[model samples]
Target chain A: MPDTGLLLYGGAFGLILIGIAGIVLSAHLVRIIFAVALLEAGANLLLLLATWHQGAAAPIIVAGRVPDLMADPVPQALVLTAIVIGVGILALALSLALRVQRAYGTLDMHEVRRHMEQDIADEAGIDMPSSSHAPAAVQTARQESGA
Target chain B: MQRLSSALFLLGLGLLIAAIFRGMEFGTVAPIVGQAINSAAAEQVGAANFVTAVVLGYRGFDTLLELTILFTAATAGGMVLGKRSPTAKRDPDAGFILQAGADLLFPLLVIVGLYIILHGHLTPGGGFQGGVILASAFFVPILARPGTRMSHTAVSTIEGLAGASFIFIGLLAMFGGEAFLTPLMGQGELGALLSAGSLPVLYLAVGLKVGSELAGLLAQLSESEAVD
Candidate 1:
């Protein structure tokens, strides 16, 4: 029996929480991208909720008559801008993901990270960090040497 | 052990957010600027949609900056996804039904997109929504017929011109002793198609710029070689 406001706020917060969990928990690049999108959507909804009013009509004049109560227009305009920006960022992210997949031949985040670290170390002409999840042989060798 | 930590961290985060939410008031804040804009938008901008007035008339510069961001993202995306090799295998054309459906939907989408954009001042939909539709209109055809390449040169040209004209219109207002992007010309009769002074023109430019930019970006993404 929660009121409309509580329900809306709950939905927005739930979306945000889910999106954050997705971003933090998912290892796949595409999943991460989608999570980012979900987070953006949740944020947009929260923003729109900030100015919510009960029984408010859309902020449009029809037939030369203004309604008794009109919803806030500024937030709507801001949300429109945010949405377009989100789309642009998503497209860029996907393209970058595509490049990363092509370059590394894998989309798994941990594998990609390992490859990238290796590449960077190699470029720097330094040995790979022992702390990294390198091969079992390398780990054993480092452990034996330490012992 | 990792899962346990992650779950604990999420629980803490959720509790924190819930605590924050509990203290805050909802649906009660007075929208000072919104109320002011709603009262004055009709006479000042002559647009039925007050949101449109705020977008193209009051906060036009923000819209312009948004367009720039979209342009930058699209350009960087294109750069990231470089030229598809001539020898790379392309996705085969879709089935006959899909191709036929695409052909059927193309004109309808274009018409609807244009209607939404042109009637933005009086409707719920506006440049951004309509522009996405327009983009899909072009992109759907490419999805159906992979061989039919969209002319990147033409898209870029249209995008550039549309973006320029948006700025040009704003600058024209500056010449007439007003601030940038100030809605010019007669406000005309409210609710009429041609009534919103320069707002409709601004939206037209926005719609075209967004549509072309998106279409080109999509085409580039589709053309890139699929990673195995």
Candidate 2:
């Protein structure tokens, strides 16, 4: 019989794989951030599951009766910390994506990368012959602005 | 082509995970750390909840570092999404139903969050969980009134003071002839609210610090969105 442990491990890794697939296949920056979130959620679930036991109750103490089987408290503590930190990092990622969208006018990863490279090249004063690049409009505009 | 590669990678990863999962045992008893914590936590820390003892007493230093990580993330997020000029347009307000719902639930959420944080020594919830609840409570208003910004100054001060006070309490424990973060006063009867002494106090500091940090993160994200 398949137990809860097997299900948990399977579920967590499944979510992680899905997240990785989303990150790799999706072009939109926002979807990529969501994929990152899925990855974090999977990791959090895995961390929490690592401490589970067969008959263990939650680590909370009742007034009179002492629990015979108490779940491990350390992983709960660790995962609590991870969840908060996950929120922080995800928010950071979202804000960065927002900035990227505002700057480039598109959320497509490829386009953003091309624009970012062009910006860097412009900043470094490297003259990239513009004939080969597809987004020549952005490059030509940069040239026209003398920026 | 891109989707094909991603699918191939995912299949490989899943295979690896399945292989790894097969080795792990299921339905086992608790680990050694849980046993030790359960046995000694009552006598040593005087906290009824072993989880609380682990978080606020045995592993207090790690909790402090966790708070620091949260603080650093908040600071970095604020820097990344710095204040925009006043001319930046605002996000549209939420609809009346959503706004009203948020307003109605906000106070209830705050109270529940406080209960969780305050009763952490005796219950399942603790500083980090309660703090997140409190932070979510604060976020309701932002959803209701799109342009309203949280006070960065207030949030920063709360965060800084709470972190400082956590360290200070640990120092006080050190002065009381115990190791750092050792419960200072006498551990009262188990399951009592004030029984855990420094444990509850540390939890309170943690709750405030985490709540403010998360609320600040939300506010900064909203502010950046509004500017855009």
Candidate 3:
């Protein structure tokens, strides 16, 4: 069973890595968010199972009750913390997605960037040689505008 | 591409499992878990469950952060879905059988959740498990009646109070010349439910806090779409 649990544990980890890969490779922000959530869940379950890992005994300490499955609480603590953080990140990301949707006509990152460039230039007065030099132009503008 | 992604995911999962097994092989994690459960002083933590002890006592700071995450998530979820009056109403089409069944299950869940929280000193489960169970019970109601709007103020009040109480107990112990959360009162009753003095109280607070926060999240999610 240790082998089996290890297999389950390994499988969960693999899913997590894939989910993370999905997040990184995907073009869609929502897909990325879903990927991230899947990663988080896989991670959480893995942590919980760690409490049952072979090397560790069950968390129960018994006078005579017979100690069984004993995985560490430290990881559980860490995972709990991670889960909370994940929830906050999910919510914050969701709201940001909403805000972005409101600002731009679409949620596509590629399209939004195109629309944002014009807004950026308007708000930031481009005078440099090219679009690539927009940062330097903005810096010069800021200095010209003065504190 | 779909098949490829799935395959890659499975491979990564396999490696991750290996990592977990490798971790178990290290033997560092088990000793600590076993000892905490077997401690003679376990009863003082106000819990009957050892897992609860680790969660609410020996390593409570982690739990604190977890609550913060839930609270923040609930609040953010409110912000997202609450921003717009979503025309996406709750699907009122559930068969009466499913809805009624959930209603019956609610009380049982509540009892089990309470059991989990209360036994957290001597057993494996703790306030977190119980709290989530309680929250699920609440979720059922929201599912049944999607129009229900949980009072944000009330939820926050409960969450804040319970959280403060956990810390306050810790502070009290500190004042009494014990280390933080060092159950100032009881001896380890071993298998008894009420043996772990302050632990039970801590678990109580945790359960209350978790239950309320989760309920609030469900309430927000169930309401009309958040957009503005």
Worst 10 residues of 2 chain A by lDDT: A138-147
**Per-residue lDDT of model 3, residues B1-228, tens digit only:** 544666677667667656655656422235454455446334445443555666666776667767776777777666765543445545554678877988899899999999988877776667777888988887886677666656778888988999899889989988998777776566556677657667788889988998888777666655645444
- The worst-scoring run of ten residues by lDDT in candidate 1 chain B lies at B1-10
DockQ of each: 0.65, 0.50, 0.22
Task: Tell me the number of clashing residue pairs for each predicted model.
Answer: 0, 0, 34
Clash-forming residue pairs, model 2? none
- In terms of lDDT, model 1 sits at 0.92
Kindly report which residue pairs in candidate 1 clash with one another.
none
**Residue-by-residue lDDT tens digits, candidate 1, B52-107:** 99999999999999999999999999999999899998788899999999999999
Best-to-worst TM-score order: 1, 2, 3
Fraction of the true interface contacts (Cα pairs closer than 8 Å across chains) found in each model: 0.84, 0.73, 0.33
lDDT: worst 10-residue window of model 2 chain B: B219-228
CA RMSD of all predictions: 3.2, 4.4, 7.2
Interface RMSD of each: 2.0, 2.9, 6.1
- Give the best candidate by lDDT: 1
DockQ class, candidate 3: incorrect
- Determine which window of 10 residues in candidate 3 chain A has minimal summed lDDT: A138-147
Q: Model 2, range B66-129, lDDT digits (tens) per residue?
A: 8887788788878877777777678889899999999999999999998999988988887888
DockQ of 2: 0.50
TM per candidate comes to 0.94, 0.88, 0.74
